[model samples]
Target: MKISRWLVAVIVLMSVSMTASAEYLETKVNFSERLSSSAETLVVLVPADTQELSLSGWSNETAAQINRAMQVREFTGAAKQQLEVIAPMGLSVDRLVLVGVGTPSDLTRIEAEEIGAALANHVNSTKAATVHVDTSLVSDVAENGRISASIAHGVDLRNYRFDRFKSEPEPRPSQSYEWLVVSNSAAEAYYADLQGLANGVFLARELVNLPGSTGYPAAFAEMARAALEPLGIEVTILGPEQVRELGMGSLYGVSQGSQHKAHLLVAHWKGSDDQPIALVGKGNTFDTGGYNLKTSSASILAMTTDKAGAAAVVGTVAALAAERAPINVVAVAPLSHNLISGEAQLPGDVVTAGDGSTIEVANTDAEGRLILADGIWYAREHFNPRVIADIATLTGAKVGALGTEYSAIFSEQEDIIRTLRTAGENTSELVWQLPLGPYRNVTSSRIADRRNTGSPGAQAGALFLQHFAGDTPWVHIDMAGNALIPSASGIHPEGATGYGVRLLTEWVKIYSAE
Candidate 1:
């Protein structure tokens, strides 16, 4: 997951060459050019003036192609009112695409991107060997470069297919894109950072899409160790005995039901000797809702994705290492599977945590916070990190509050909250801060030191986990909503979303800059 700076540099270099080689064609009003004039598929930049059907130049093409291009124009034109339209002139290609670039001076990076993405989608469907996106109307070099990068990012991420287990796999198709940017120099300089971001996103998707059976605790740890250790990252995996030695009774209690032993994995990337930024993840490899159990088949079917938070942490740390960002980062992943068995910890049982705090188990289904508690305690007590953030599919209440669109964040630190919110905005993986204080009342128990669940209708379960984080300036991310996708969007497919990786990476990037 962590990328070395060296790898990032290499990827950037390749991107620059690729973008430069992709030619950009310019067309004036009333000009008709053959789509297959060049080896690459043509990209027509449609200005907003041409969005409406005028029939200035037309005829002899299938109505379906014209309609599809019109749909693209309508969709892109509404968003960017000044966009220009592009289409193939002759029958050399299967289809022609209309890319809309709004007004020249008023054009934004996002608008330019809409054109590029539209072009990519057009080429992908046509099975074209190459795509030529014309960007002659735009004058700003920086904006052009950003648009190219965004287009590439969208196309690459959206095209991802998880066909690993498919018996009848489709043959790999050969296709390439040629981006015609106004300024070649600007594109070259901006390509590296853009590619690094794309790489990070791709890595996150891969980690999240892996099946739970193949992504077990030990297997996950091994994957981390193999990918990171060679890149100067220090990797450590603590077995059951080691976890018990540290008094992680809450974590052990959850693992008692499953055959697979628990594992606490630590991956450290010391880009600086300064105080480390700590990230803890709850790794419930498979959650059958413990003794409470899941009622519906859907709930049980998707329980394997409970480890999504841990997967995000692993992927983020790997990207950081791979990018070689100059900041000290450490991740703690507490892995376990919640199943039913004679040895499983029963409800109402009180268990001691790593910090000697006892928790009353009101619901075995609330196991995420238990393991996360130990992980947070371990991070603080052992690493003494400057700031700690723990992510987990901690509560269904979070999903009830935010739906599947955003994550719910609970933190005592206002500055951290602000920074995280900004990062979320940039990445589109938004986080809405919720009240953890209200949940504290429910977590306070009479018999044990604390209870996982508070009052009967406790609304914010993310805050309940904050109680065990101590004074580590911790933030709890309830990823119950953001971990997977029920539908596809932008650059993400339906399945594991890998939501937090980009947000966390952006946050770390800002911290390193500071």
Candidate 2:
């Protein structure tokens, strides 16, 4: 039955012809010094300190009416707060949207992005055909068009929708926008780089949202090639034979039961002559937890998201390459499936990694660390990177430790940890540092060099991966809690959050700058 299913999947994949590009709402944005009187919706930015709606951007009569309404509605222009008026008494536009900019301190790039996201959600909900944003009043606080570009970037992030597999996808309303900015602000130039980042995020979300039937290891490699190679990225796919030749027994053992062959996908971008940073991701295309098995329905359904870390690696590289960042980086993804089959690795099986480390499979369900062991080893051996950061949805203990608000980061290097935290804060992909060395005792093994499973899941997983890092400055990010969300909120719509793309992209940019 599984073989027939695999054949059907192959036929379906081969027959389904479509460009492998990421799907996102392409909101037409234009920057102008002149504000248009005719618009389906007029979005006005107001500062919290500016009481009575006192501003030179609008007519006195219009301002007076809005101020009266603000008093009646008690709209103080708080951050992420808005006041909407329909068919305003003096406005030419059909509707008026009063969005708050909070205080001077709140007028930042991040705040601008959030405001943009909030504005996009409102505009999308209203299905406005054309919208005009008046940003003249914000020039004092917003510098160099950063706020304007960030707002647009947030809109792009919030506007993402993955409906490719929908038999009859719901039609989305189309809208165009114009940003009325201060003269010579160069908002368009600033937005160009942000657009690239949005593309990368969309790609990651699309990969994660894809159903298991269509997103196996081989298919993922092909998709990565199709999406990245044209952008000047070098993509290499190591098949089962090549994987075994590299002695990636630990990575290979996890896929022994699957009909779809495993793959070690390598993506290299040589943007500079500096030593590259290595990013290793655990990619379990569809994990059934081998013989241990995920008994609950929710646990089984969530298995499709096990490959999210790999998706982020692909996304980050794509973002950096598209922006033409001046930094060299390499991505290593170990892709496989842990399914129950006669050939699947048993709980007691001992496997040898590419780096010649022996691991005892104390729990068959702990397969992410097993694959990551080889991936990290391969990256350090082949790429000779200055730093190695491995990301994975490795353990449920991470969710318990940090919940869904932050990913658990484990690293002995203070510089890497601090840099990652700053990047996370800047991008809103938050991370919290966890203990690394104290948990090494849990990985001790009686029969092998180490054991895959131990007490305190998150730390054990991190410690297990640290052994393979081999003196390289490494940070292990267990993003099991934040990779996928239950519903749409903030900048994300729903399903896959694409948690690490923006965070990692920012990290690369910061690292490159240093």
> Which candidate should be chosen as best, given lDDT against the real structure?
2
Question: Candidate 2, after superposition: displacement of residue 217 in Å?
Answer: 0.7
Question: Which ranges of candidate 2 are over 4 A from the true structure?
Answer: 1-22, 35-37, 52-60, 104-106, 140-144, 183-185
TM-scores, one per candidate: 0.81, 0.93
Cα lDDT for residue 285, candidate 1: 86
Off by over 4 Å in 1: 1-37, 44-87, 90-94, 101-120, 171-174, 182-185, 456-460, 511-514
Local distance difference test scores for all models? 0.67, 0.83
Estimate, for each residue in 1-514, the C-alpha lDDT of model 1 and write its tens digit.
2444543443343233222211111111111122224534555454555433322245545444554557664544333333222345543444445555555546554444444445444555565675565555444666666655565555655555555556996643346556667666666455555444544455455545656665666666665565556557798999888899889998989988777768899988898888999989888888887898888998878876788788778767766776677889998999887888998888899999998989999889888888888888889988999889988877777777788778888788887898888888777778898776544466777889888885432243555666666777888887886776777565665677776777888887775565
RMSD of 2: 3.5
Highest TM-score model number: 2
Model 2: lDDT to the true structure:
0.83
